[model samples]
Target chain A: MLTVVKNQILVCILSVKYNIMREMLNKVTFLMNVTFMILNNASILIQWFVLFRLREDIGGYTMREVMLLWGLTAASFGLSRVLFARVYSLPELIVSGKLDSYLVQPKNVLLSVMTSSTNISAIGDLLYGLILLAVCGLGVRGFLLSLLFVVTGMIILTAFALFLGSLAFWFVRVEMLSGEMVMGLISFATYPDGIFQGISRFLLYFIMPVGMIVYHPVHILVRFDAGMFFTVLGYACLLSVAATVVFYRGLRRYASSSLMEARM
Target chain B: MRRQEKNAGANVGVLGKREKYIGRRYGLPGRKYGVIYRSVLMENLQYAANIALGFFGYFVFIFIFIKLWDYIYQTPGELIAGYSKEQMIWYVMMTEMMWFGSNAGSVGRQVKTDIRGGNIAYLMNKPYHYTLYILTKYTGEWSVRLPMYALLAVMIGTMMVGPVPGFKIVAVPVMAACIILGLTINAVFKICISLLSFWIEDASPFQWLYDKLLLVVGTIFPVEIFPQALQPFFKLTPIYTVCYGPAKLIVDFRPDKCVEILAAQVLYLAAGCGLMFFVYRKGVKKLYVNGG
Candidate 1:
């Protein structure tokens, strides 16, 4: 069993490396794309920059805290996209019966699908997050804690997307719902959590769970709480398991569309 | 399945020959492009589920902005950056809806695909103005989608924050004109970016850059809120015309501001059209020179 797990990890790593290498073949273009995305994301920070310049605090968050919010969100989102890029395309895969390829392979299908590709621009997001964290005066300990939380956040986010994308098996054309959920997650994750109130707050924490993906992690990173940390860790683990179970269960309902196309 | 087969057959040159032959026979440019527009509009309308989902996504963003601004206001009548919270929220709603309503065609993505897939060669042989063909398709899609977006905006705006203050019955025609101008500016920007695919392997980066500029410069905040030093620079940007100008007028209608906005829109429209034509014509020449 341990050997099997190790083999899967090896395959995942190799696949990611291969994908990165393929993208980086044209070093100049890859660098340009990455630089453009970093600048694009940094420009978004200007909105908060102007907002903070106008007001002292927003919902109890200082500019520094807002930076942390954006930092964690960007880092986690980047990590998820880089490691589990298929999470974004799962709806298309399921609906189009592209899952047949993974099913035929003698490996963990979910992990195989998750690690199939890496987003070239997401590397920029990862670097930008670290830059923001550094600008916020994060020390080594803070950096380490952030890495841990970012990984946890990535897992939960990917799992959440999988759960949503799995709905495509049971229902036709839920791709929009999956897409909207992902967009909502990305949109809400960057904002200061305290601003959300009542039903919005509830949805943030539960239905959409942008809170679990970014807010909780940032909160724990800023001021470590044993209970909260454990809760987040547990939530990530449980959600990952639940997502996997739901996907496999739904696989039975995935009627092949016979629209298969060859991939390089 | 039959439609898919027909589409596949069309791609394999059967339908292309027929369409090309028809285009060559009929020198009626307007009718041919009109058919393209109707086809694209009908194609978009057929996907009701997709349209609803898109509206829902737009709603989610506006809903969040409303909540965020509601929290920011803190006081009932406080103004920041020369806008009361109500005006600010309304401004965001209008700008965000302008994005939804505009015919911002994914020309960049389409061009990138065409170049990467070597389909541009075939497209160049077609007997229509490629840029005009795309613009018409975009306009048709925008026309179909705009009503749905406007209805949702009004419904959501009325529910969340009530109607825009000082709105007049006459404001409708003026706003409609502004919306058309705004969409034209957006379409021109997209076409220019798409044209970049002739030179760059991935024009997507350029599109992302343009979108970010629009978001930060105009969509997220009104140009009035920009720093004094940057206000002129922001005004010089097409973003002011595309998103900020019309949205501001909707929230606070003034005859003078309306006139100024319309004049700027026309100027930007002309400039945008000129730039688009230059880029596209040059890009096509380059493509041909490179044996594309």
Candidate 2:
């Protein structure tokens, strides 16, 4: 029994190393990639700083207040890239038949493939995003409430990212399709979720869950609404399970092909 | 390393005397510059329809955001965050136009494909700075698209009920400086992304990453809307400086702050250009001439 346990650990280590290798080979951008990240991020920052400093209380938001709202939008976008950045990888995997190699691997292949290597630049985007959240968080009436919302919002975001990535199993050409959906979600996450009327709010809350990622959690923090905490927790748990089931189910449909077949 | 080629190197130094001319390999102008520029322009122009469609497609998004923002603010009939209905509406339109103006990303893929195919060495053999030549090519491309976007903006101007100009004063010199800085930053980004071709076997993932990030940081909504805690870091990031600075300057000019922003813009351009050189130098040094 002891030897068997040791063997299992060895297999796990090997699988981890293989995943790392696959990631390193793919994500390493010699020099150009670094420059691209620097330039683009700089432009984004500049736009944020300028032209957005005004305070008018039209909808119960000051200049900085709106900034805080906008900040959440940035956070959702940044987090999406950081965690589920691999969702963008699905189309190429399908077209190239690289998914075949994952099927033959020992570990939970879907997770391994999904997170071969986190986007290093996305770490910057994530940091930038959290900083935005913190800025908004500073205004919260209760510190503990803000932290709770952050945690719950993160849970919902993770589940959503997984659900999107799993869609690639059915749609081989899911790049633009997934991209558009995520962008639309970012659009939704930017605003205060409560502004939507009865049906619109319901659509966002249940149908999409994007509202829960940023606006709903934000609303909870500002007002210290107790109900949201439980509701968010329930949704996070349910969706996390759903994401796993969808990805594994998608895996069964992945048919291995060759470079020659792929080219054809 | 071949004996016959080594002995013949001295003779081929003379351009017309050699079977394949080597004159273009140095700073000297290749007679083919005009022809090369023309062909590149021609090839780019073939995709004009796609460019028009892309501009229109992105424009639709502005209206959607406008509707959404309007709905969010329906009950309260005052400015949310100092943005009047008209100013905020134009804000959406301007941001979209700003994006259309500053995109040099598509050309980045050309460099990556060339690198992957091992065809970049062919350009290295030409008599021009690769960076300058590529920038020139993209400048021509943008020149074409900028007008298309301007035309669309005019249509939006006439059709939309949003930010109409209170008056028209040409912020010419500032605008010029912004354009140059914007283009330089964009060109550098393309070069940076293209350089990844040296390390990554395929460039598709890198391209997608760049595009998505661009949508968020480079052009989308202004970063001021970000939470206060997040503002400083977003401001410091280089992308916000490049793509955001120019359009914001036009939409809302602060002459006192303009110099400082321009200075920052210049710094980013310099940094982006310098980074490209460093990358290209190292990348070429490590380059294995994979036979095409």
Candidate 3:
């Protein structure tokens, strides 16, 4: 019995080792990706430079602050693309019937969907982020705390992506919702979360949760505020739990219609 | 058997809840008889929401900019770098709408997808021009959007801080021209991006990159903020032509500058149209490469 089970495991491992093949891009894709990254970086640099004239300090943040904010933003945004861009693809997947195959899989459907498209541009965002973080100058103790903040911050971001993606099961056509969410996030993200005060700050922190995404961890690293660190880490874990519950709950009615028969 | 089917679905995760919560998001079914027209019209009627949201969003940034510029202009409190706070705000509102309205044509990339998939070949044997067919399809949709938007502009311009330019007879033509120019550039941009799907597999990144660049196309802030040395080069940029012409109206519709702006518009319209045709011809060649 043990030998038969061992043989089965070995067969599975051998097949896996062989089947994870990937194809190479034939020049155009390479050029497209490289050009897109270079141009995008150049554009952001220009905006940071131009907006510099608005103030040595913009909205109570310095030029270095702005650049670092942009850098961290690029990283966070890049990381989302690298890991969670498939969430943006939820509508198309449902419409095209691609989710059915994922539904029948033994593993979680969300995990499968996210893994399907490994985003390349996100690498650029990640690189830009690291450079920006290094420049932000958090010192040794500050840097360690900042790293902890960013890691937790990423968890909160993934939860947000999952929450938005789950809407696809109900809405079926949620392109605009996702786009509006992106715009709303961008509006809050471009400036320091400090510019917002009172109720608006509440919305940024707890309501929409972008402040947690940006300012929570940033506050520790920048010496703005440190107590928020424990709150953000705790919040991220809770949000992830809430998000998973929301997605699976949304997935239940997935009648999946007569369209994409490819899955079942 | 039915129970078995239900149980099969109930086994793993997300399936059960979607069944109960499926249709709760909207009440589109309320108008069942004209579901076809109503759905189409309802979809287009969403422009009201877009316009309202757009105005609110525009006002936020304008206030932020006003505060920023007020600090700069505090010494004189009149004008700085050829702009007053009011003029700058007006430019912000108009440019925001124009850029929004133009990029709205981005959905046309689905048209390109259809072409690449040879789904467009369905229309090839039809009697009408495919271009005209799409134009009318989109126009009928936008017609519902236009009235509400015009009203939003009127209300916001009249009630809220009020736009400097309004229903003035002479300004109407320029604004109309601006709207037309916005739609045309958007359509052409869509076609060019869509045409790329013929050669490359995905056109989405191009669409995203192009739209984001519109932020710098002198829409949110004047090109003059780019520093004195860069202004001439900024003026000559094709991107500047689409955004700046309408913006000029809000900035100051000078009789002398009208000729220049109009000339810029004519030049942009001609160039965009020319680029679309060039891309179309090349795209068609690529399509045939795949026996498509």
Candidate 4:
């Protein structure tokens, strides 16, 4: 059993390496992708900058807290996109039956599918997030804590996306619907959590859980609490397991597309 | 003898057999544009779910802004940046509606697809002008989407803040004109950017940059909210024509201001058309020279 797990781990690593090598083959295109992504991330930050310039606080969040919010969101989003980009395209994969190769492979299908490719542009997002953190001037402890948030946030976001994409198993032409829901999720994530109230706030915390992804992390970083940290960690773990179960359950329904396909 | 007669008769037609056929149906100066426009409008209606979901996403933002502005107002009749709270929310709704109505992504993407997919080669040989063809098609799609979006915005706006005060019934026609012009300006700008793919191979980054600018300069908040130093620059850019100008006119209509805004829209429209032609002309040359 240990050897089986070891072999799966090795296969996942090699798959990631192969994807990286293929992307690096076009160094200029890869660089361009990263640069533009950085620019795009910065451009979004400008909206907050404009907002903060006008007023000192929004939903009781000062500029510094807002900046932290963006930093966490960008880092988490970037990490997921860079390392497990397939989560975004899972609907297309499922609907088109591109999962056949993963099913045939000896490795764990979910991990294999998740690590099959990387988005070079997301590297820009990751770098930009680090830059924002530095700009915010985090101490060693704070920076380490932010790193913890980045990993947990990525896990939650990837799991959330997996859950959403898994719905393709039962539905037809759900690609757009899933895409819009993800956009709606990101839309809420970028804003200061203080702005949302009542049902909207409740929806963010539960249904979308965008608050868990960025808002709660920003709050925890600003003023750390053991209970909140543990809750976040527990939620991430629970969500991850739920996502895996849902995906495999849906896997039973996937029919093949009969197209010549590759993992990358 | 039969082949010679066929070849000789084909020359009498304006361009080709297909051209003669399509031209007769859409040949008239006024009717040609209408036919292409209606076809695109119908095509957009076929993707009902996609359009519905898109509006739902837009609705989320509108919901947020209504809350944000409500919190900010604090008083019954407070004004921020020359707009009352109600006007401010209405302005956001109008802007969001116009933003969605642009439908410029598909316009630019179609251009890129045509160029990259090598469809441009055959499309260029068609009887109609490629630029006008794309513009009419997109205008139809925009027209189909706009009324539904506008109606939704009005319904939501009324529900959130009641009817807009000082909203003159007469201003609706003027607002509609501005909105149509905004859609045209947006489509033209995208077509210009997409034409760059004939040289750059990937124009998406430019589109992304342009979209970000539009988001910051006008869509997120009005240009009036920006620092005074940057207001003129924002107004001069195509962003004003696409979203800011139209929405502003709807919220705060003045006959004098209308004249100025309309003139600017006209100027931008002309400039956009000019840029579209210039880029397309150069791109076609590049295509021909490179055998694309």
Q: State the iRMSD of every prediction, in order shown.
A: 1.2, 6.9, 3.7, 1.7
DockQ of each two-chain model: 0.60, 0.07, 0.13, 0.59
Q: Please identify model 4 stretches exceeding 4 Å from their true place.
A: A262-264, B1-23, B29-33, B288-292
lDDT of 1 at B228: 91
**Cα RMSDs of all predictions?**
5.8, 9.7, 12.4, 4.0
**Model 4, A51-124: lDDT tens per residue?**
66656788898878877887888888888988888988999999888888888886788998899878877888
Q: Is candidate 1 or candidate 4 better by DockQ?
A: 1
**Which 10-residue span in candidate 3 chain A carries the lowest summed lDDT?**
A15-24
**Chain B TM-score of all predictions, in order?**
0.86, 0.78, 0.69, 0.88
For all candidates in order, the CA lDDT equals 0.84, 0.61, 0.62, 0.84
Q: Worst 10-residue stretch by lDDT in candidate 1 chain A?
A: A255-264
DockQ of 1: 0.60
Give the B-chain TM-score of model 1. 0.86
Write model 4 residue lDDT over B1-292, tens digit each, in one string: 9999898887765468778787687778768778878887888888765777677788888988887777677788876778888888888888888877566798999999998778888888977789998888888887777777888888888887888878888888988898888888888998999898888666777788888888777887888887899998888998888889888888888899788888999999998899899889888988852353
The first chain of model 3 has a TM-score of: 0.80
Q: 3 or 4: which has the higher DockQ?
A: 4
> Per-residue lDDT of B1-292 in model 1, one digit per residue for the tens?
9999988977879878877887776557588787888899889888755777787678878888888898778888888887888788888888888786663746556667776677778877787777777788788877777888888898998998987767776887998899789887888888888788788777788888899999988999998787899999988898889998888888888889999999999999898889988987898777743453
lDDT tens per residue, model 3, A69-178: 66656677776666566776676676555677778765556666665554675666667666667667767775566556556656676677778777777775465565
Candidate 3: residue B233 lDDT (0-100): 83
Better of 2 and 3 by TM-score: 3
Cα distance off (Å), candidate 3, residue B104: 4.3
Q: Write the per-residue lDDT of candidate 2 for residues B11-79, one digit (tens) a residue.
A: 566645553444444225544455556776788688676566465345546655555566545555566
lDDT of 3 by residue, B1-292 (tens): 9999887877744655665454443334432223334555677676555444444444445444444554444464376457776676667666765654433553466566677578766764565445544544555455565555556545554564455733246776876776666566666666667667777866656765776676664766777677888889878765566676677665577766666777777787688778877876677666643454
